[model samples]
Structure formats: structure tokens, C-alpha cells
Target: MSSKQGGKAKPLNQPKADKKEYDEIDKANIQKKKDEEKMLKELKAKAQQKGAFGGSGLKKSGKK
Candidate 1:
């Protein structure tokens, strides 16, 4: 009978997450992520030092 009821119903609010508790697994995972990030940085530096990957892969001849 009400206008609100005739319209779409509102969604229920989601429950908030509780405080995070870091256990041994969490600590190990975090360490692994850090190691991966460090390795990525090193690899990026090496790539930059080496210059662009293999250039444009085409040789331009001066002869027409």
C-alpha cells in the first residue's frame, strides 16, 4: 500500500570486519611478499641496465 513498498527494496548493510590478528602464517606470507617485491626491483634494475629488450628486432639497410 505504501509507495516505498511498491519500489525496489534496499539492500542490507554488510557487517564490518573485526580487527586483524596476524599469526605465524600471516607473518610468513608477508615476508614472502616482501622478498618477491625485492626480487622484482632487482630484475627491473637489471633490465634497465641492459637497455630495451633486443631493440626493434629489425635491421635497416642503407641501400635502397
Candidate 2:
């Protein structure tokens, strides 16, 4: 009979992983994505400021 409650036990000491070095192209791609996100945020803000669409109900004319 096992008294352990969890599924598996973890190791006491874990080795650290090496840091990844980005190339020029990778860096450029990352920067491009960030710029795109920024532009999208700006556009969204502008749209919100403009407010929602006009009334959906029927329009009434000036004539009786």
C-alpha cells in the first residue's frame, strides 16, 4: 500500500535552461508584430471615440 497522495513526485534539484539568442530576422519579425499590435490598438481607440453606428429605427420625414 502506497501513502503518496499526488500522482508523481518532482525532483529536488532542476537544471536551468539556456537562453535563446535571436537573429536579425527574428528580432525584426518580433518588432514588426509589436508595431502591428500598436497600430491595431490605436485604430480601435479612434473607432471607439467616434462612437457606435446611427439609430437602427425608422427615420421620420419633415413633411406631415
Model 2 poorest 10 in a row by lDDT: 50-59
Query: TM per model?
Result: 0.58, 0.60
In model 1, state the lDDT of residue 43: 97
Task: Predict model 2's lDDT versus the native.
Answer: 0.88
Overall lDDT per candidate, in order of appearance: 0.91, 0.88
Tell how far residue 51 is off in model 2, in angstroms.
0.6
Please give the lDDT score at residue 17 for candidate 2. Answer: 80
In the predicted model 2, the residue pairs found to clash are none
Best by TM-score: 2
Model 1: residue 8 alpha-carbon error in angstroms? 29
Could you tell me the TM-score of candidate 2?
Answer: 0.60
Q: For residues 1-64, could you state the per-residue lDDT of candidate 1 as single tens digits?
A: 6555666888999999999989999999999999999999999999999886887767789998
